[model samples]
Target chain A: MKLWLTCLLFACMPAWADAPTTPTDAATWLNRVAQATHQLTYQGVFVYQSQNIMAISHISHLIDNNGEISRLDALSGPPHAFLRIDGSVYCSFQNKPSGDIEHRPHHSFFPEVLPYPNTHLNNFYQVRSLGHAKIADHDCEGVLLIPRDAYRYGYALWADSTSHVLLRLIKLDAHGQTASQLTFTQIDIGHAPTRAQLSIDFNDKLPIKQSGNETEPKAVWQITNPPSGFHRVTETVMTLPDHAQPITHLVYSDGLATVSLFIERQTQPNTFHQQGLVQQGQMLLYTRPMGQYQVTAVGAVPLATLVLMADNLAPIERK
Target chain B: MSHLAYANKPHQTDGGHDYIALISAGFDGELDDQELLTMLDRHQSDINASCWQTWQLIGDTLRQSPSTHPSQLAQRVAEQLKHEPTVLAPKPLRAMHTRHMMSLAASVSVVALVSWSALHLALISPHTTQLASSAPASSHAIQIAQIDPARLASFVAAHRDFALSADSPDTDTSTQNTAEPTQ
Candidate 1:
């Protein structure tokens, strides 16, 4: 009788495992995540982990009446903070303006940034549906995203069933290990947030200053051979925080992905990191050296795309 | 999640495989004129989509370059044909006038032929025969620069049915023949 009970339990287990209370639909899931990032106004605490670094950050984001969004964050890494409004980023240090800031800006677009252009992604990646899983204590659905080619890596997303918020995002590397991970330890979605919660506190005693000098937009640096569809967006002469010599910050983009070209005075650490891709949540980073300073470009696109961009860096001096 | 999830997985929104294949074939010389034309047509949407960004990066290089090297008479002619912008000119007006041979030639891909012929007007160049093999088999097609380093490597890889982008791991250099030293 005990032997008979064991066999019955095994058969029931498979059926029981399949039976879940509910799972959120996948097709409508990504759109909900986009809505949470854009429409919902809330402050949340999140944890980010990578192969080389682990950091925690507090983000307070708000969408104002003009629909212009502002994000204030105090990232706990060597004590630096960012007050970013749209494209411009103001990096602050320990409750004070760091130094004479040379704003080297790249057009950073977020939240399905290039919405229309991605219809092409369907050709290369077969989007598959996985039932559901739990992430950050939220009952989340599982999504299996497969790459069509080896040029890029793939990802698995766990989105909250109730709120449609992305609770966990895992970026997979070539070896199938977790190259990067982003999980929300605490989250509040679809809740209204107050202005006091989102705004940064600056001491009234200090004078607020914008230390960047805008360059002439048409300062041309012609590339003899760039990859197809790319053009030189702009170039600026700026100084780095530790270095005295002004470096040339060149930026390039194709409406969707962005590549930065920084020609600075080369420093020690001559053993440069091989063209790499470091992911922290939605951001992807690729760094390479030009004539001098190491050119580090970061965006939401694939690392290979940026590596090719940097490798094909042909020199052009105002022609 | 099972590790296999990461092993063979990719984002559903990552769709540059066909494009990378097209570019590799285009550069590798593996794609025949018909194959090239078919790919160009089929990938019209994708080219404008994912591949176009990288293509834009490559196009910027093409636009600012006369990279067709070895000081070939063919490349000189192609360059002369490229710089005379004819895209904005109304066609009927040019057809009515006989003196605008440059504009008429610029309108047609055959401008490479005229400019090339003019370069070899006085010399018996051996490359003319080699160049004939380089032209698209069909009258209407996207012409791949058979000798350009960027195009040559890519064409060789593509024709061998391999992609040249980050996806494909190995490109055998033993297949490296027929291309003159680019530098």
Candidate 2:
């Protein structure tokens, strides 16, 4: 009887241990996704699709004592690769050296799509779980973020049930159409990629055009009526290779989405004189001539949001 | 929005008004054989040729063809001129017969096209080509220009930098430490 009871307890203990301990709430799952993105060591091949375009890429992310390092190589189209180490991004195109090592904040790509845990995502997005599904042979629970307003797009995310890592993401338009998608077709978790896999050799002899350093300039332009939830994040003046005059760049973000506004004086005789709107995949661009300056706004938000920001842009008196 | 109104307003024109109309008609693909002859004849004028080159630049920029460099275009134009068969030149229209209404319409279209082309050029990048390959075909298919890939890159790069920074670990409000994968 003692032996039978001990065996029975051992069999029953497996059932207890298998019971669901994973959080069912979407916010907790989102937090887990964010944490896994930054903390985990993983490598995978993912397919990114937007409208009629589809691209396959390989991504390898590793977390070490020096912090996070990642490499993404495009497996389709023209050869392009990006190496991100902590906050810096280095890119190479057509196997040619991209001269500048840009020092900027992290830009989330596939598997790293969640906003930081501190963002007020709940205020702008209704987060809910869409149950479980199998992705890349891994059982994943889906989290849907429905936008509360028309200003921003919605998102649906699938995170691994056991590892809590995000495996797939779908960007939804205002009408709930899939505007873009990124899904891993194969992935290996909990293993660090070899250093050789992450190395980028820039020994090519192609002439590399240098993107000069950026400098912060005084805020002379202001948007009087920006869309709600959107706030200015950074403003700087940078010299573009083609433009003779410096362009003032301003970035605005509503937690998940971002819009960049570029302002430059119309010094050239052939400056753009017409106002127009264009859409490419999920991105929208609006440009209008403002007095002697031309303003161009680009973002992945709705056209209304871009128009509102561009129309409200006004010059402010510096104190 | 007010800029649209400003752009639409008519402005004073120089002696190149008639040439501008012909250039605009050529861009719209509405030029006839005779009009083409007249345009080719007027192409000798510095102002008309410059306007023609500008229009070509806009078209080339929209097409994003690498061979559309200004110097290459000039060479191509010279080559085509060398191959042209000499023929009787068409009679030029009388100054009084110049269509002012047509000229005005052409001017407006040119303004719209210039503006449209500029914005398209600003937005397009190599990344766009990689992503826009699957765009649905249409009669009025939108052309993605490549006037300044570097500028577009800067905007996109900056935007991504800031957008992702919001959720970065440095700014995380949660007290949970960045955890390792469960072995």
lDDT for position A227 in model 2: 73
lDDT string, candidate 1, A1-319, tens digits: 2222333444344344434333333334455565665555555666667755565665555666745444434355334344445544444445333222222132122221222222344443434445677765678776644444433445566767776666666655543345566666766654435554433443211222212232544453444554444456567665433334455556554432345554445565553423344443334455555654455444434555555555566555653
lDDT, candidate 2, A1-319, per-residue tens? 2222333444345344334444445456677788887789998988877766677878888887767877777687546566666555555565432233332434455667666574566776666555688998999987666666666767778888888888888776655666778888989998867655575443332222224547777777788888777888778887665567888888887767788898989886447665776555466777777889888888887777777888889988766
Q: For model 1 chain A, give the 10-residue run with minimal summed lDDT.
A: A107-116
TM-score of each: 0.42, 0.57
Runs in model 2 deviating more than 4 A are A1-28, A92-108, A200-210, A268-270, B1-183
Instruction: Give the number of the best model, judged by TM-score.
Output: 2
CAPRI verdict on model 2? incorrect
lDDT of 2 by residue, B62-173 (tens): 4456676776676676666657763433543322123433454455456555665653342221123322343223222223333244555555544445553212111111
TM-score of chain B of 1: 0.24
Give the worst 10-residue stretch by lDDT in candidate 1 chain B.
Answer: B162-171
